[model samples]
Target: MVVKKNPGKTFEDNLQESIKQSNEKIFFSRIKDTYIPPDLRQKVRVTKNDYDCMMFARSHLFTLELKSTKEDRFSFDESIIKQHQIDKLLEATTYENVISGFIMNFREPTNKVFFVPIKEFIDYQYIAKNQIKDHKYKAKINKSSIPIAICEEIGIEIKGFKKKVNWHYHISDFITEAINTYRSKV
Candidate 1:
């Protein structure tokens, strides 16, 4: 099924809606930043969570960081996904029945979404770094970005469908697959 594009709705919104439609037992909550006035910015410091949303499904907890990029690759630099976010996701994996990772939306030529586990992401980063360093001139590297091709290989690709009003992704299936994959590796 084709995803019905709504210019106003973000990928996160769609995903959340999809989760809502999937099941009642699955609990999903988006971690929204507290609204602070511009004048109070100097007085208060805000620390954000590593993931955008948290899900509790079938006795398992999941923390997912959502990212949408028009480009073909996602860069690991501080400008995109921060160092603290990566650290937090990695730390979350240490706990039992906790699944943490990223839900990336590639929204350019192809509107494909992928759920990449934190461990796989870290492993890919190391490989990408070495590839760039060893073959600086020969490697087809794009500013240390993880290309969509690699994401497809290492990540669980999530399918999308058009519902009544917006595009909804297969969040339930993603959760099941993520859990199974993580369990298999462990």
Candidate 2:
């Protein structure tokens, strides 16, 4: 019997590959140490619209939407941000005790990271849109642009002038940082 290939299968595969490549033990370890929740199986699931990954560790829940590019930077066109993407991110925010975020992993010119809190990220998108309307914004709305803006605005992890980041280390680092930062907020 022949089997059909899922159109989204490639995207899902890439997402899982990135996660699998990253130091998952450290990711879970950090989450485990930082938050005191019941023991539960770690689950990462992909859905059509809601989130790229719905990660559950015991009772700790995290909604992660991932975007990747071979470019060296994060900034992209606002058109790339789909309505459903924003809608699902917004939905994650309403849930209590859930951490929702957008993760950008750039694979060119060396891997770079941007793990942004979803609520604040959406808020900044509006702010960025307004800023563009008010003035002639020269920047493209890409992966890194608004996220970097919000990181600076909110005093999160700063990916400064440093151009190169080791992907293996950085992915784990980003996950560790995201878990810790959001865990503190709630």
Candidate closest to the true structure, highest lDDT: 1
Q: Give the TM-score of candidate 2.
A: 0.55
Candidate 2, 103-164: lDDT as tens digits: 66554464444666777676566656555454322444443355433444442342323324
Q: Judged by lDDT against the true structure, how good is candidate 1?
A: 0.80
Clashes of 1: 0
RMSD of 2: 11.1
User: At residue 98, what lDDT does model 2 achieve?
Assistant: 74
Off by over 4 Å in 1: 1-9, 35-43, 132-143, 163-165
- Location of the lowest summed lDDT over 10 successive residues in candidate 2: 26-35
RMSD of each: 5.0, 11.1
Q: Each model's C-alpha lDDT?
A: 0.80, 0.52
TM-score per model over all chains: 0.83, 0.55
Tens-place lDDT per residue, model 1, 1-186, is 999664424677888778878965789889885778999989998887677888999888888888888898898888788888889888988888988888888887758999888998887787677764563233355558888887888789999876675678877788779888885562
- The parts of candidate 2 lying over 4 Å away from their true place are 1-48, 72-79, 132-176, 184-186
